[model samples]
Target: MSEDYQLVGSGLTVCEHDAPVEGPVVWLDSPSAVLEFVAAGDVSEKIVLARGGTTTFLTPALTAGVKGVMTLQGAPESHLGILSREYGIPCLMSVAFERGVKSSRGETIPPDGAILRLDVSTHPEGRVFIANGNGHLDVAEPAEVDAEAAAQAEQLRALMASYRGELPKGSAGDRQIRARLRTGVVSTSDENVRRDLAGGEVSDYLSYAGWNLWDLIAARQTEGESGLIPRQEYETVAFVQQWSTYARWYARIVEAIGVDGVIELGSLPRREIGTKVNHVHVWATLCPLFGRAIATELGLEDASARPEDLDALIQFGRRLQHGLWGGGPGFVASRGYAAPVLEASWLERFRDEERRLDDPDELSAFRRFNATTELCGFLLHYDCRAGLCDTGPYPLPDGGFLLVRDHFLHEPGYEWASVIDDLPHCVTEAMFFRPDEDVSIAINDIATTFAQPANYLKHLSGAVVYARDRWDTPVSEVRRLDEAEMARIAHRCDEAMLGLYQRIGDQSVDERIADGVKVYTRDMMMPYARAAGVWDEMVAAGFDELSDLARDAYPALTGGAAQQVLGAVFLMGQGLVPAEGLPPAPEVGPEALPVLHEIAIKGSCPDVDGDAEALEAAGLVVATAAGLMLTEAGHARHDELLAAQRESVDLGRLAAAYERFLAVNGPMKSLSARAGSAGEDERFDLVGQAAELVERVEPALRRTADVLPRFAGYLPRLQEAIRRVEEDDWSYLTSPSVDSVHTVWMECHEDYLQTLGRSREAEGSY
Candidate 1:
């Protein structure tokens, strides 16, 4: 009979079911549809069966007095399911009624207004009874009821209720006890401590503390209010709270497992064990306890989510690029392009050999020089730009590239000199194999971290339980695997290592190339040259002819000031300059101005008694001209550079909108989730937080729209959503409706992707 029914969720009932609840069924496809239906004055008790997976839509429905909820599809432990269990709403997921139920005319089964009965008394899988016609019923069994499991489910429900805030509400005595536990001062008497530990009160306190710790961490990340505790001070407080709480949890564990359990774990000294285990026993016991506590606190639920995995990937990639590709031709080319002096020499060498390549030795020298020169030129021409490219700190062919080039050039007898002949192939090979090898090494490092038998056992135990909880694996069949099986699993996990590397590398390279073109374009360069009145000078004198003179003239404009001048010219071209032109005798920002003024006064206008305005104008012109000729060769290579800059600016603004959304809405969403189990006062406090965060959304959206016109429509919709929430209709925060905050946010997000000419599949959903 149970096999005949589609089981969605199995657990204890959240609320009492003295009798079956029969109600009219309302089938809605989305949160907006539900909102529309409810707002239309349909107040009758009904069971809502939504088509989508998100459970947040139920907030409004529940407020409107829903009898029950059943989703056609959703994970049993999804956020929606968690909310249902917390709200004590009779809920079922993965109903599959679309496939299972059909009418005589072949329509989908359980149409709106169809009467259905849900019986939660059965426990675990509740029974669903449908009234077909003339009072006849079609019964579906969920699962066989388990009494103990039902009891545990009830306890979990109670526990969730208690997690609303710091102190759980109850009789006066219970409140006092909770307060004492929270303060970490549970009666100094040894007998009282022992009794509480034995009675499971210690476990309860630890659970509360753990939840509070997570809440504090979340608050720290999202906190923005001024005059509140400084971030460092808050961190110190959190650290102390964690230490004290974990100590209590560890003490409870020791008490439960007994002295023999501690000794068997080999944490205690044998001599100290007879009387009182000294501080060593406690410290040793705390080590593993601390590890577990930290892991739990950090939410280490997935291997991919672990920081160690990311760190390992970065470390390996860095080593591969620096170790293998370092000092290669590509590296040399990148560096030579950045340094004008080096670039002039490198290009001259390449052109010289090009004319004499008929000889074998000349061909070889030209090949080596050309590869390095091209690589350096490529990086500079395509990857270095103001406000667009992210060319890290060092100029290209970075230190490693330079090292390789130096070795080959200076140490002709070096063994790697032979490798320099085929530098391009060497760099390409390194790029291809780096990620795969790095991933393998990273996985092995992780495996080694669990080399200790106890740690390995813990990891295996966690893996089994995770499988059971998430995948519903039968516990009896989930015994620890042999070494061969474990190795196979590891091998399977690494199957996509190369693909992952390629995907990341390709994305990074594509972005840099796009940025390089946009920032280093002739159109963009024209504005600077025109502003400096160097366009005609550069064209007549020739960039190569003027490069040395410009360098010699602005000898002081090296390091950061050189970069700043380039950036200032780019910004000026983008219309970031003041309307009145140069400010007084001193421009506060962009250090390049003072040096430019000095050079202009000295070289361009050395006569006229140093007239401040004339000198400033002359300095501006000279600076602009100097910037134009500085990287003149790079601009000649690509025509699409200016267009790329525009596209990059658009994408950048869109990205900023998303980042702001996360920063502002992330905390609000967290608070909303907690509000479900919160008491009235706490819920109100959560609402206040949502209001504050929502107020900032409109301005941010407006700012985003100002930068990119395509995003303008989102501002009004977002503003309206915030208005609704602030006006006391709080459901708009997560409402599935079109007017809800989440819906509007997603719409803006979708628009961003569309405008960027990127596909949803390519970007991937959150």
Candidate 2:
């Protein structure tokens, strides 16, 4: 039997031991195959070797009766390896398995029902032997196996003993933090909360859900035992030290700045605003520690900090830290919860595909683009430092970035290469800045140009009114606000809004445009840009477009009409009654009269044919302005128009159109992927297909815009991307740098979820 066997494949061991296990070889090709084999009771006492890389669906089989797992593809940090380590399952990845092999004597080797022996103790390379007989004697003795397990258990005991005694030392605040961790509030059950902790050994609590510190240490000692390398072990140690140091700094800053001061600094009413500002405060406090982390990661030495450049260093460092921790799995998971309708709908499709074995394309595609995967990929590409800041330095569960360029290189379609290349590079360079740059002065200058009182007022009033209107029950119950008090708050918001318009006249269109770009880019869009790896380029392009539009459309916005229209549009989008209210007459001077008339005729403004006093008496008009102000009657008319427009929208039709759009859009991957190293003609052909799909969905999107005008911007943006694609500017095809096709599609989907008042978690299939 031994003579009949032949050599097959070799790979690195995931769980190291001197013992060997022999079992019948079971070859599985896909997730469904694994499931089928388990259901059929064929997995018992078998060595399961599967094709393809790590997938979430394979988890069930891995946990079943299989003796071990050998995969054609998987990395040390891949989901398979992670699970294997967690479950104490012996595994090998990147295995080369031979089928229908013949021996040197031209005899069939290891025929059907072959017994496979997997010996993993050999360092660097493991061995796989196959024998023709069902029983092979290469398996380790039972006593030896038991002894090896006992040794591992003893090692773990010693490691845990050491870890438990090493209490963190720090100031009072730091002690308080450590006390909280010891009290169990920061344990595995509270992984969500612990994930948000800025810096601390508290992060280790994530591993408590599965493996412990003992496992980590033992794995490190055994080298390849835990599917991690020596460098990874060193980094893990560094991470713990860095986190503790930063935690101390964070504690000191909180003590110095006071919790109230930090809260006050993040005055915005939004929950995310408070959270992000708190993160910023932490970064600011621990600037030096973060600088060192950046320097260490970038292979830089400790340099002298110039007083003049300190602020810039701090700002750049803050941005870097934010990029690292912000917009990670926790953030994206929160988005999933908030937008449950979208999440549920997308996931339903994914599940449907998962159920079908005959067609795995959709399942594979969905897995690649699912929200969690996308978020992880985003972190890898943008937040983690790897591959020109375009490719993902895939994040590990332990707050470390895993360099996984080789994994992408071997990915099935090679589309990820194009995806990586398309990402912007320079934006992440902020994290690696030298000590002398005057980044602070530039940041301050930009902030000054962008700070507009009107924009702030707009956001504040919008938030206040939106809360009061949409959350009336909760607000009234919580605040015990009577109608009179609620009315007072509303009036105050209106007054503030009125003040904003009055100040709008102080700045010219050019100035407003510049300031708007700064505010929108830095304050509103920067977070998204950082996560998407398109910060500088996207902001510049978006602002450039805004500037061009303002210049070209100057005539239509004269005589303070721009501000009025803007306020109207803003309020309407928020689902709040326009404060300026629609007016019936010429509120503009002679030069702008034609523009105002044109607007009214276009049904963009209300037309007043009756007496103003009668309209007010009827409660149709409350107060008249030099500009449009809607009385009760005018407000009703406006609502009627909106209602009519909304009535035109068929949700079912729109949903189907969207589904069709995704079906066509999903396969295109990226512009370069479609081009496929082919000639320009092939690229143009692919572009035409995408453009045609865009055209197909235009009518549905237009109808959607009628109901929710916020969606109106998406159609134009999609058209622009298509136009750019047609002009051979392929970057716009799927580029996140600007209003690319994919970006606009995603925004449109978000609008649909919002307008329909649907949660991503609960929504039905599209």
Candidate 3:
């Protein structure tokens, strides 16, 4: 058995003590794989292998269900590694394969289902071993179940089993109806779709139900009539459904910001504001409204605060309502949740027109992400349930219910008119509260009305199809679980989602909710900061800097400060609100060119002698109190010089040098960004990162210097900056106004790109 095993790969261990874990390997290389994972049952014993280092690939529920993780690239500081640590899972990254086999998806890995062992008893280095002939690892252990949580698990299972309601007829037949309905909404005329949808009977019933529930809540009523759910129970279910929706909204927003914001850079950090601000619009307005209502209803203290302290929080509502919306109805189409339900063709035509007008490339910085038009927030429920999709069961006026088995049919709370899938966990967590406790029991206690058949097959089906249609999933490769199997997996997935909710002790539930708000802020904003390349500064300021900003402004949604809102409007009117746009380049005399370039790259320079006077005469450099600085004109002139330099340099040699520079730049950028926030251990690691980066970047610097000798100045400048950084003057690492390591590094990068005739916007590597 021992002879049957062979070492296949090795990587840096994320958490050394958590190594030596063994499980069958399963690769998640595509969206289809993720959907398949959602459909599969008993994945608790499977070790997941992926290529990217981002946590967005796996949903939090899916991550909780897996055994361990391994990646082809990324370090312990990567997002996936951070999540693994939070979950107490073993992770290894940046694996170097000794021998490799390619899978159908074009990823190289151990054969799927092969038992593998990850041993990292050696601390930093971890090894991967695959079973050869025996196909087994002797030390593999079954996952242990916690005794304390088992009782709650049993209660949940029992509750699910108690459902006595009628299920949708014929699983395959139901799926076809749903597929057609979804297709109709996206492609056909809305009139025909609406006619097929029983002339808005579904929406009518949903509205009537919602109104009845609202009225009951207003009356403080809890009793129910025969064959109907109690008003109080409905309220609890509604709260859980809404709570889960908010949580999922937060997660999805983070995913969009973290993943989409950096797509142009391929895992490198860059500041992309379009996605961030767009999401902030929803968070600041509609999300806070719901949060405030929830807090008030629960008698919990409102977490609202003033928003002016956070740079990102200012003027989001004004931007969303006026600036983005001014582009047209299409720009705000996703948020038009209350608009009367239109026919499918009308919606499609509207979408087409919007696409034509909002040429994403030509849009202003605030409108750059015109592609993020997917309906989100409470809008999703309204559009799917009350609008064209009409995912609700209705009385046909003749006989049996017209159960439109569309995208949300099997979702637990959808028939009750909800869209979020994390409701099981939400309900389980909320069960610790009063009305919620009664609501949880009332939901399944009757079996046939609310959240009955508590399965998510249709929800998963719609999600897979959504991915296929919107995200370009390969249609032929898609897979679906059968009804029974889906039901089983749904139960398990819900249990997995309930992990955090299950660990409650005697602590106050209100405090738990508050703590949840804090966690949500840190988790959501950290990724945004990282994607924006401000994680280090934010962390160094005390993660509290970002956290407090999030805590202060987020729950309040602009913090409810009148002055902040008014100031944003004023800034917008003056064309100063979105302040990062670039100005046109300026032309200058050859004599003034280098001086302007020096000031531009170094942030400022000593006026010394008559250089500043000459540049000032040329309307370029300005003599500031600090020193010689580039005016707007000077900066533009420097840009002109940057563009013209390509004609005088060896382009081929410069490109090659830049490629080498990139190999080291990512680690260097990450280290410099983290300098302010590193702990003692992390400080030591950063030192190693700095040394390693210096050694690796040397050849690239030397090659570039061969092409442009002026570039020779960068190496020693970087060395001096690093030397200063070592002496505890940390500002030498990234401060822009000096020959700091990052400053000199970016100067070299800018010069290299300019000499190669490349645009930073086009390359998106900044």
Candidate 4:
């Protein structure tokens, strides 16, 4: 990296819109944004003022005199890449720009530094120029661009100007949200779109409301709108996102109130008769994961009794992320999962029962989660006004995943017809809030909340029976450990899990050893099972690959009732099912860079209909079996999807992917030169080769944006798991390895990236 790079500027500035309040400056985090910037019709050939260090592609902009009329806003290393490879330009981030801008106009640079003189090559039409390595900048000569491109860029710039005003201040975020909300012509400069893509209250509401509403809006405008992410769909993601908005706020409220902030909810003004509720309802109906003794003691149900009872409930609340909302095994007789029908002969009734609601497996949990999420939505609406949910997406970094299955999750909304279960609104409303104000608790609060000794004894009762198939240890022996170390281990494991869960739920969970175990148990083994199953099933026709792990896992554990205990452990692990298969990228091959990028664009998964073929046909490459099969027309469908998005991105994800692409291609001088020739465009030429370069990367870029964060997000969690394994605590591991968050998050994300044009072959790793 050099200390000095200079840009010489003529007196000129060009962009379709009025100047941004701070004076518009380019901040390139992604190559896609670079492409978009050139395609925006905002650059002028007359000015060549470089503001920062140079980078590979940006050099020509300076050399062609489009460089540094104003300011450049990136780093020196990045700037240098754009410099020596092309012509030099002055950029503001440069020390020279600062000294020059601060000093007078007629300043001369010291002879020791690299200095560029200014020149002009203006076009009659208002077209911006960007370069391609093919001796043509992405910017085209005036005649090469089309009217539609110019008009669309203008339209987007207008929208961008408006987006800039939406943010009251600072960055606006709420998961994979802003991208979903983007609609209509996109601003050429993703920076411009980013400047405008902020929302305060409206975004807050939509965060809870779900992307479904956006889909709903678009659905109304379109013909075939059946496939959309329903806000109320029966999926864990919807459930998580629903409360995330509140969780974000609740975290703030806690900071504002205290660790005991939830208690204040009980004292709030009673809701009007018709007002929608928060989670208080579901909190009421669901059995506490811990049990009644604790719930009653916490002023949860207004019960007064013994010290044991008080200790029990407190333990339950403290143990689970959701405490005793649903009673544990003790209540299982009448409060937990089987509570609704334990003695009612529901299981027996299944033998002869006709097809009906409550099939036990499908709708139950899914229904419960969505019902609660929607309730949380209404509750959050009140909280925002009432002074509870305050911090933005709560801003904590604790992240995880949830599952979404079509036949299982989809259901009619409250406003739609329901052919599904006819459960009363009371049960549905139960999702509002669990018993105590502590929403950060877990459903696994099965320790103190169960009927205590009684529930423990009962669960063991069946344990004795199932132990008959064990690997030599008597059921009585394993059950002995339950009594001997049950509560003690329960306490230790409780502390660890609770610590992990709270951090994760609040998104404030540290990426430390404690959370690492969570990632491993949750991410690795689980995902291993998932990917194994999918790979096996797809590779063969048998779904039996899952059976081996199921068998091997229990026998491997030490204990008599080990199977039963393991089953329970598995259930606890079940909550993070979708994330089970996450694994870091396999291995990508460097020489296969273009193919890798194409694979990343067009998914490697058979289920995907990504941009592989399309990007290839559009001058990219597809080096995978799945990609080669897609027709050019099929690829166009991929283009249509990307073009239809209505949101803005920092383009950081795309940059990472492209950077990965660059790394693979860095050595291939031939391809790099070819890439240089056609990739960068100068003037806004929507239909010509210049436009084609932008077009080739846009969908791939969007896909890069869509999936990478999900991948990037898993790193801290993964590192934490590595730390945990080193500690060797036999406690339940929730991390991505062996079974952790990072594992699945990585796999799922990598899988998506592979579908895009980025292939593993090019990167030299999967």
Task: Name the best candidate (by lDDT).
Answer: 3
User: Candidate 3, 342: how far from true, in Å?
Assistant: 38
Residue-level lDDT of model 2, residues 1-766, one tens digit each, is: 2566645657767655468867776665543455566667656587776553353334335535367777655544354554454344567766655444433333222333577888876655677777654443332222335778799667545533332222111121122222233233222121332233332232222212112222122222221221111122222222223322333333333354443332333221122211122222222232233223223332232323222233332223333323334322211111211111111232232223222213344332222222122222222221111111111222223332211010111111112223333221211100011112211110010011111111111111000101112111232222222324434432332233222222332445444334333322232223323333444554355423423222333343433343333222221211111123221222222233222222222233344433443333223333322434553334445445444544566667656655554454455445436554757667777787778777877776776555545456667878889898788787776665556776666556645554344565685423
TM-score between model 2 and native:
0.24
Question: Model 1, range 395-498, lDDT digits (tens) per residue?
Answer: 12311111011100111112222322222111100000111111111001000110111111111101110011111123233232333443333232222222
Tens digits of per-residue lDDT for model 3 on 1-766? 1565788889888755443678888877754465576567777888888776544444432334577788876666443453455345677877766655665644457778888888865657889988786333333233368887798556433422211111111221122222222122212221321122332322222222222122112111111111111112222223222332333333333355542332222111011111222222222222232332333333343323211211112122222333322322211112212112122442232223221123333222111110011111112222111111221222222232221111211222122213333321110000001111111111100011122221111111111111111111233322333334334434443443232222222234333333333333333344344445565554465543222223433333322332222222211111111122212122345656666666665576775434564455444555555778876666766777766776787888888888999998888878777887877677656765786788789999999899988788788888888888788776787788766888888888877766676888898878
Query: What Cα-based lDDT does every candidate model obtain?
Result: 0.35, 0.36, 0.42, 0.26
- List the candidate 2 regions with Cα displacement exceeding 4 Å: 1-78, 81-157, 160-162, 166-177, 180-766
467 Cα displacement, candidate 3 (Å): 30
Per-residue lDDT tens digits for candidate 4, residues 488-521, read 3323322332222223233321222122222212
Displacement of the residue 698 alpha carbon in candidate 2, Å: 88
Question: Is 2 or 3 the stronger prediction by TM-score?
Answer: 3
CA displacement after TM-score superposition, residue 466 of candidate 1 (Å): 35
Model 1 misses residue 762 by how many Å? Answer: 61
Of candidates 4 and 2, the better by lDDT: 2
Using Cα atoms with residue i matched to residue i, what is each candidate's TM-score against the true structure?
A: 0.20, 0.24, 0.26, 0.16
Steric clashes per prediction = 15, 24, 5, 157
